[model samples]
Target: MILPETTTVAADEWVSQHRYLRDSGLRFFDLLVAVDLGDQVTEVVTHVMSADATRRAMSRIEVRREERIPSLVEVFPAAAWHEREAHDENGVEFAGNGDLRVLITAADPPPLQRSAALEPRVDKAWPGLYEPGAVSGATRRRRPKPVPGVNEEWINGGRQ
Candidate 1:
């Protein structure tokens, strides 16, 4: 049975901590991802397992927008793609990866970042809100609130 173990490490200690975990037992790299905590910090987490898959570990490093955590590509080559995706989605930089190309959309602010606006929700009308000429004499009740994650100022040609 593989029990999950988690450790939160400082950004500067990220690479070293992963190396320590690898030396201890977790040798098989599983995956890496980023989570936006909405506190101006992005939590980057990587999961790994022992060679026999009997042990598992998860390492987390929190970094602010301006900070770049050291890349683990040297220790786990599979981390390169995951790092690129994280960078593309959340704008988290991996210092040594060297190939942090945009793996997804090329939006100015990363889409998954908390500060990034959800333009589609603002630009398009919610399907449930209106159906033109579908219902006869169905008087509207009230103004619908903007969709979640969309600013009220950008709704109904409110703001650009």
Candidate 2:
């Protein structure tokens, strides 16, 4: 079924309302995907199957990046994988999910968004003694200068 576009259902209600479709032989929980709108909100889409081979049903749910949405794992345990993928890729939250941290790595940054500076500064200054290619004998090797004191060390470390 095509759900209401703007309707917001309680987490439990959302799952309960769809349980019948599952029991009616809609055994496939195809995918759950989200699109990032560059703000705190995302558009989530859930696809399911019907008994008829050619028929399909989609239930869409909008979720804020900060807030949690209903988890479909209770109805279709297969949904857990899709839920985790949505959470990882688009930063969607699935409330009462069995494993919120699954399929996510600590090194992965949060979802991308527009801001004052979208690109990073590529030309930052650093102190090092090295030439573009090879230094000639006439060109004396630049002495390795100590970075002023501990303050410079701390600043560079923080940037990294």
Candidate 3:
């Protein structure tokens, strides 16, 4: 199996780098996405391939959570949908996409961001008072644990 060639570029050079790749024969736009890197930064990645499928490449740009990267819609029109999905899910903006309407959940802080609190998973009361799978009203055997990746203070109504 062949792996896609990966290139990490600065946010300002994103469009230009992709344009170079497209011009070099990786003209097939595969996908675009965002990965939440905890509370400080997010990585936006794009993949493109040659027409014959023999060559592929991935481009990545890491930016602060609030920063916006240039859009690739002018270079690859199909990037609009993927960009919108990345925007809605991770709060990363694709500047100049023009059609970045929400493609998924409308939750604040973007559901996929590492700092986002899963309210439903943390707020709902479990039937077992003491522990999961235990009988209701059972005596406490241990301290209740907070949901993974959710701040305990936040779940308790205190912001940290």
Best by lDDT: 1
Model 2, 1-160: lDDT tens digits are 4542343345557787558668777677777777766556677777677646455666666666678888888898988888888777666778878786747643244433221121222233343434556655556366445554323333333364
Candidate 3 least-lDDT 10 residues = 121-130
Tens digits of lDDT, candidate 1, 43-72: 999999888887889988889889889999
Q: Which RMSD does model 1 reach against the true structure?
A: 4.7
TM-score for each candidate, following the candidate numbering: 0.76, 0.59, 0.78
Model 3 sits at a Cα RMSD from the real structure of 4.4
Clashing pairs in 1: none
Query: How high a TM-score does candidate 1 get?
Result: 0.76
Number of clashes recorded per candidate: 0, 0, 0
Which parts of model 2 have CA positions greater than 4 angstroms off?
A: 1-12, 102-104, 107-109, 112-160
Evaluated against the true structure, the overall lDDT of model 3 is: 0.81
**lDDT score, candidate 1:** 0.82
Superposed by TM-score, candidate 1 places the C-alpha of residue 146 at a distance from the truth, in angstroms, of 10
TM-score of 2: 0.59
After the best TM-score superposition of candidate 3, give how far the Cα of residue 61 lies from its true spot, in angstroms.
0.5
